[model samples]
Target: MNSSYEQELCNKKLETILVIDDSPTNLEILHDVLGSAGYEVLVEMDGASGIEQVEGNPPDLILLDVMMPKIDGFETCRRLQANPSTKHIPIIFITALTEAEEKVKGLALGAVDYITKPFEQEEVLARISLHLKLRKLNLELDKQKQELEIRVAERTSELSQTLNELKQTQLQLVQTEKISSLGQLVAGVAHEVNNPIGFISTNLHYANQYIEDLLILVRLFQKNCSNPGSEVEEQIEAMDLKHIDKDLPKLMSSMKLGTDTIKGIMQSLRNFSRSDGENKKLVDIHEGIEATLMILQHRLKAYPKRPAIQVVKDYSVLPKVQCYPGQLNQVFMNLLANAIDVLEESMIENQYLNRKESTFINPKIRIATTINKYQVIVKIADNGKGMSESVINEIFQPFFTTKPEGKGTGLGLSISYQIITENHGGNLQCISSPGEGTEFLIQIPF
Candidate 1:
């Protein structure tokens, strides 16, 4: 009994061969040979017990007798093969009825092979070993397939997470760029404001002293000699009274002009940087474009290439359009800045090729605004070397640029496109051909 229990436990890890035969001689002979060959063997005298044992604990191989009480080996094989759990276990039929049809019948009932009544111990072991090895290979393949599926799933999930992180990083980078640009704008505004303020401050100081001196002169005339002609007149001439009378109003007027310039700068800044506006408001698109132009004026001056880039504006009387003013300003900034960069690059290329403005074409950026009843169309055209179709097609895709690395972020056109189409429900289209220059048409509903 201890030996039997130990064998059963070993069979859990090793191959356990089940043999069913009604003949004691056949069963004993087969069990002894299989057990000697290092197989864990279980024997049943009848087919019924074999089926019962199969249901309880399936085996690696089944050896059966065709003749039996209650259930024959063929019937037993059929029953085992029909079961979902035991269907794959190899079944071998052993019988004394060696007629061709009887062997064929036994094999037909789901038997993998047939053993004659005087079966060789070697043949049975060889077949059982082959089938068991095949089963082992199949199980290993199943395990590997499952492992591969798990790996693919994990890899897919990781890629998805990585894509999300990259998108978030891109968004943060855009926000940082916007903040940096705004900081630069603020600095420029401060410098522009300080200029007029400085001159106005100095002029106002001199004007204050001049007015005080004039008041003293009036008091003297009232108190002492309101009609003392020659001496008072000589004193007034010595004070240069005629010059003060003429220049004092002019100085005050210049101070007022300085204040007016400061006021215009402030207004432009407010229009360009509508940071608090959330909902759409009626805004003059021309105002936004001009505000952006003022911000980028320093880049417009004459460079080494030729003269200053001439800005030709052909604006029609446009009614205010409802839109997000700040975002619209951003689009204008991007497009105008892009035009400037392209024109600069084209000029440099011409210089490299020893082609001057006389040989090539003069650089110009033309802005034309017109309006239909429902929409305002602003066309910004530049007379520089244009782009090929390939370049123009992908101009609005993020991270697409021909500019040298670090010189351009490549997000300008993409962001501008989004702001126009997605944010404002407007359209932005580009028209270009090689050597023919480029133009951007912007349309927004009024």
Candidate 2:
């Protein structure tokens, strides 16, 4: 026998059979028949006594006799089925009552089988064997089902853990790329600041030396001007004092203008840099945009092939928006950079053709912003060669770039979309077609 069969057979043995009958003759016959089949026999003369015996020590199967005094076999079976501990034991009804209706009643009351009087010993043995086999099969199925459920739960937990790890790895890669882009932006800003500062330093030194000369003349005038002196007048004439007086104010004004330029550039740099703050801030959207433009100004400079790209700003005064300024600046940088690159490519093509009046002769970028009742809208449009339908559809997919392999990581627009839509509650959309220019529309809630 298989281990499964041995386990059930050892545990439930088929060794003990209980006989309940009022007639002594019937009881003796059953005892002898069951005993000859290598089973131990226990007898109860009444239904109540049989129930008592079964409750004391539950058997794998019970042989119940009907039509007994006090409580009947049906009542005994009902009592056994009521207890949680004894409910699963199979009950077979053995009765002298030949009425088919009585047998049906016994079976309906939780009896597994019904044996009529004048039953053959071989038939009794065969029916008992069948019911025991059915009982054992049910136990095996239940055990297997529990084991399958445990395995499925373990696999599900492992899959969930792996998915979380993948997401973490993706986030790390995004941050690394962001830092690399920031370095390029900083270099551009430094170049812008260096131009004005360089001139300011030289102008201040010249202004200081001019002041020393003027002061010496004033000292001479105060000390010796009570009496007229020919040499003093001669010295003033040689120095061109009148001309110095006339140009001194203009020099100071020029210096002031240079200082103001440096200050504006520094402020723009601060605004762009401070946007990476941990907390959201109420900020002037236009200021953030101007800062981004400043960072990108170098890209708009004229080259031999093309004049400077014209930028038309149509800004509407609106309420300040609460947002992560640094992140929004990143989105602006991405969109504007793409526009400038596309325009440059077109300019190169136009130069090669030597068509001074080509369709994209003077490439232009237009930025317009407006506010409705609940949202702020920004549109950045470029008059360069526009994208095709396929390019537009896939633009926001991660690592999907049209630029040459090393020139573009394809993550710019995709990361920008994540910043606007996921980081802040906003929408970024692209509008373009072949031979037409491209427009990026951004909307953020108030």
Candidate 3:
């Protein structure tokens, strides 16, 4: 009893083999050989019982007999191979028939190899060990395959995300270049306009004085010598001298006003296009906002379809801020321009629906500014069809836009957001909802 217990304990540490056969003599012989070779052998007398034993307690290898009572080894092998849980277990067929056709049939039925009826102890042990090693190697390969596939999937996702970021960076560079080129062009145009305006303004001042002196001389002559000659009187009446004397001064004043307005516009253009290079400068924040509004004046004028969009300014006195002047101007321009666009669209919609009388109030943009010790705040609000919460969430994302495809490049707000948050270390926030209107709040450090 002690020897049997010790043997059982030793077998527990060895590889287990399940042998299925009908002949007790063959089972006993094979079992003794496998047991002596350091393998734990399990025996079953029939194919059905063997299948049950395998399901109840799995083993490392299976030995099936070719000739059996109820079910032959072929049918048994087929049954085990058909089961998913048993399919991977290695099966070696034991048979007495040495026919080539019979061997081929046994191998085809998923048996790893055939053991002749007169079992060679060495051959049986060797075949079982070889198939066991192959099974272990296959499991390892499958695990490695799974790990490689997971790694490949993770790498693909990372690369895809990187590709999208690169695309956005490229587009942003293109946008920056375009803005730079446009600024240069605007600066050049403003410079050109300045010269012509200077000439007209200077000459108009002298021309006004000269015309005034000539008028004064004529008045002196008319006052001192009323009857200088009949020809002079006739000429004065024919030329309508009184009307010219009164209207000429007013016309010159109007001309002067017109030139002054043009000069102001040119100055605003120059201010808006001022490039600050790589350095910051102390600048009037209000000046930047004014310049942007001046540039967008044409869009604010009363159109045939709608009344003029009103801009109400509630500016608080603010000290000059040290910042990138050109970029700050760009942010203001983007925000104001977006407000104008939305207002214009809303106006058109109102007119098309003929709701101007009831629903559409005057389209207006309200701009307010305030300053504290830590930061300066600017607010731009418009009464227009606003965005949903979902849209507001993605507003700062590059390439996100609501404008029609060709009408907008969708870079303005994203670039503006970067300029405020990343460039100036400022904060930009939006508040909006459907049909309620939209408001953008900008806060910049002192």
Candidate 4:
């Protein structure tokens, strides 16, 4: 427990009692009686001294003598009551006056109760015990109220934080959906343009070859002819010899290559934009994994002296799951991309320490899929630097990412979590440790 809390408990355990009287015998009796009852007793000889003591260090209860030299009990009680700081302390008057008016006056002066001269010991003890219990109860009540207020404030703070996080996650999801829709439209346009491009590319290739042959024939004719016959001149003239033959052929060849490259790009776009729906089909998960691998091929390839990490597929024979294939493909894409990022960070760290000469040994990514009686499970495991216990615990929380700013939006796992749990009625979980690599297990109902 915190030191402040422990200190509070100790303070609560001790209760102080203040006894005010002019007579030494009376003060001694009050102190001894209260002290035996487990209260710390403070004694004052006169009303003036008692008021000072109460103001300086307030006690839980005060026992005051009504009659005293110089400053009297009524004036002291009035002083204590006037100040808000010491006003609430329970005060009982001890007096020798036996008249009804004297008792009435003491009670009117804010004394809670009165004890006449030659006080009964049992009665004095009983009244003190009763008032002390009441004081302690009041203190407990105040403490409880303060504690309740603190708890309410803390809960409100947590709820506000959660609400803010939810709003941010919603905004990111909207942006991602918009981008995905745009990608689909671009893919469709690219696919439609591919057919015309293919035809144009083929035509350009054939035209270039024809142009080359005509150029060779013209050169041969020119070399062979001197002051040639009219038939040869007619033939050269008919072939349009004055035209820029070399330039035209080169232009057509360049156009062909350009169109062919565009066609390939379009094909890649089409594959990437494939949609997921409620349509259930027999899908080979391995094919989707391979497609995702191809999409990220550039990232996997090493540059300069860096060694590329190998991807190992260990797919088990399993029944096809009845679910949206495209979404599953996206899950694979995200997992593989995250693994690549971790591995890249490791490689960069190694390079920073002048260790670039050392080659990475068996830096690999493994993906496996299997089907049980009720569910199909896909496990994507990576052998990159793993997460600690804290990271692993909060990995699925929305907008929680280990990647640096601008490198990640931190919504991939959050969205993936929503998709698996809400959309598909499945579960997504992670198994990881510090040195041991992480594995995400995704289970979809059959």
Kindly list the per-residue Cα lDDT of model 2 for residues 1-446, writing each as its tens digit. 47776576557556577787888988899888877665678898987888788889766677888888898888988988888887888889987788888878877878899888789889999988788777778768878988988888888889878875665456447854674466457657767876768777777878768886876787677677775678977887899877776777677778768777777777777677663556788888899889889878988988775689999999999899989887888788889999999998887777677765555568899999999989899999999889999999999877789997799988789878878887789999999987789999999987
Clashes of each: 0, 1, 0, 0
User: How would you encode candidate 3's per-residue C-alpha lDDT over 1-446 as one tens digit per residue?
Assistant: 37887687666667899999888888888888887777789999998999999888989999998888898889988998999998888899888999999999888988888889787788888888899999889989999999999999999999989997886686568657866887889878877888889999999999999999999999999999967899998999999999999999999999999999998888887788777788899999999999999999998998775788899999999988989888888899999999999998887788778854525659999999998889999999999999999999999887889999898878889888888888899999999999999999999998
Give model 2's TM-score versus the native structure: 0.54
Clashing pairs in 1: none
The TM-score obtained by model 4 is 0.55
Off by over 4 Å in 1: 1-255, 355-361
* Superposition-based RMSD of candidate 3 using all C-alpha atoms, in angstroms: 8.5
lDDT values of the candidates?
0.83, 0.81, 0.89, 0.78
Identify the candidate with maximal TM-score.
Answer: 3
* Model 2 whole-model lDDT (C-alpha atoms): 0.81
Of candidate 1, the 10-residue stretch with the lowest lDDT total is: 354-363
What are the runs in model 3 whose C-alpha is more than 4 Å off?
A: 1-157, 355-361
- In model 2, how large is the Cα lDDT of residue 303? 70
How big is the positional error of residue 33 in model 1, measured in Å on the Cα after superposition? 38
Residue 385 local lDDT, model 4: 73
- lDDT for each residue of candidate 4 in 174-210, tens digit (9 for 90 to 100): 5358447846786768767967887787777787788
Candidates in order, TM-scores: namely 0.53, 0.54, 0.68, 0.55
